[model samples]
Target: MLLLLIFGIVLLPKASTLKCYECSSDASGSCKDTEKQCPSNGYQCAALRVTSYAGASKVSDINVKSCAVAEQCVEGSLNFGVSRTVITSKCCTSDLCNTQLAPAPAKSTPNGKKCFRCDGQTCSGTLNCEGSEDRCMTTTVDVAGEKITMKGCASKVMCVGSETAQLPGGIGVGLSCCQGDFCNSAISTRAGLLLRVAPLVTWVMFS
Candidate 1:
């Protein structure tokens, strides 16, 4: 049981990349004057572009839209076949001298893109989660059938218990072992108080 409990703690699912969005730009023609910020303000150097994919395949003429800060433009680019698409026609703020032109539109095939599983339509996440906290928690999970033993200096007494739960998919089981020192201390203190009162009550009744 102890071995199985330890195993569960060591094995949990870790989040990983199931799919990724590919972006590109087309740096061809010259530019004149474009808005460098969002017309609504509070957003500097914002841009949006539409790219039409055209080719001789099942994944032909796929239109993609992307936007980013003009000062910090993050466009996507990928070279699949012969055609090198371009990303153009962006909306920016009034900061022309600071905003660099958006990257060229490019051709990107959603080879591993997943279809939306919604009521009407299903779409993958448009933006990536880089600094997400959930990603950090998943990274700490360990593999199944691994042994991990950590020794810590516990204070007071130790109240030990074990809990087990069914793993996802019902493929296996999981266990969580917990030892609380505060609980043990509380139990001991209550027992001492009860013992002290028991003798006094017995003596009063007998006298």
Candidate 2:
């Protein structure tokens, strides 16, 4: 009876985990409705959509569905002059709950706010902030002993819990977010926030 109780206890958590659809739009025809059993620890079914724009023309849209943590279900946006990216996410606790795509972000209009963006090694190009992008953001990481930096505008949600959101680059990120124009001109931030948005950051920086 004692051994049976222990085995039941060990199996209880696994039995309660949810099943969720997992796929990405980036992969050709990858959005087929397939499900994955999320771990019983903390994961929930998630759906995320990312939209990018260049000036006035729509550039690309990406969608992903999988298991997510509580922090990953958030909305955020970024703008850096002629380029902009918006993110939206949803999470549910039921099996196969991410059957549909997450909502897309609304179009952003300029709010007269100003920030600095990087061009090559120069970090002085004035960028116009838009919509909920009320904060200036900058990310720095050491690449081959050279610190590579990226600066731009971000929504408050993007900055929240970011210090603890460590992206998997095997390098420390000097992530900073502040209010006011050119606040990112200096690379320091009050550590506060989360959303573990790895794909969004990578797309913004490399795309």
Candidate 3:
């Protein structure tokens, strides 16, 4: 068990992205006016990180409302107030990046070559290769969300599990491709370390 735990700890660093959560709404009840909102009435937005595993990050949004009767003459059911909340996730790095846990590529034929592709908020693209036994033929990865794309002979291929530009100071890292940690990290970490330890854990846990 201890060995498994240690193995997992080692693997954790190989994860592609971090899982974070944010509130889309709150439960402050109802408010009479914007001024009555928690901000004005003494309230703040809620922060939440749902999960951070397998190089993935998630954000959750919650609602908050506040309400009160301004006068006794008003009808019992006449008063109702509400507010909206925005959900956001934190930047996932180290293990969470284009080089790790990238979104699955949608299967398609580009330039008469078969490949995978994926599309989502601020991102879209495809990957193809010249026939079997040949290196990747052609690949296109565009991250419009981050205003970038990988094309031409140098185009790199990978998956994206989460969008980075959505996070603070992460737009810069959005240019990467591939999944499961950056290639550099994978080479030095997964290939060099995690790969070495995974078998031992499997042996101890299953064997």
TM-score of each: 0.21, 0.74, 0.17
lDDT of 3 by residue, 20-89 (tens): 2222223331112122222122122222111111111212212221221111001000000010011222
Judged by lDDT relative to the true structure, which candidate is superior, 1 or 3?
1
lDDT ranking, high to low: 2, 1, 3
List the candidates ranked by TM-score, beginning with the highest.
2, 1, 3
Which run of 10 residues does model 2 get worst, by summed lDDT?
190-199
Question: Which candidate has the top score in lDDT?
Answer: 2
Model-by-model lDDT, in order?
0.22, 0.66, 0.21
Cα RMSD, each candidate: 31.1, 6.9, 24.0
Residue 160 miss distance in model 3 (angstroms)? 9.0
Candidate number with the higher TM-score (1 or 2): 2
Clashes of 1: 26
Higher-TM-score candidate of 2 and 3: 2
* Positional deviation of residue 59's Cα in model 2 after best superposition, in angstroms: 2.3
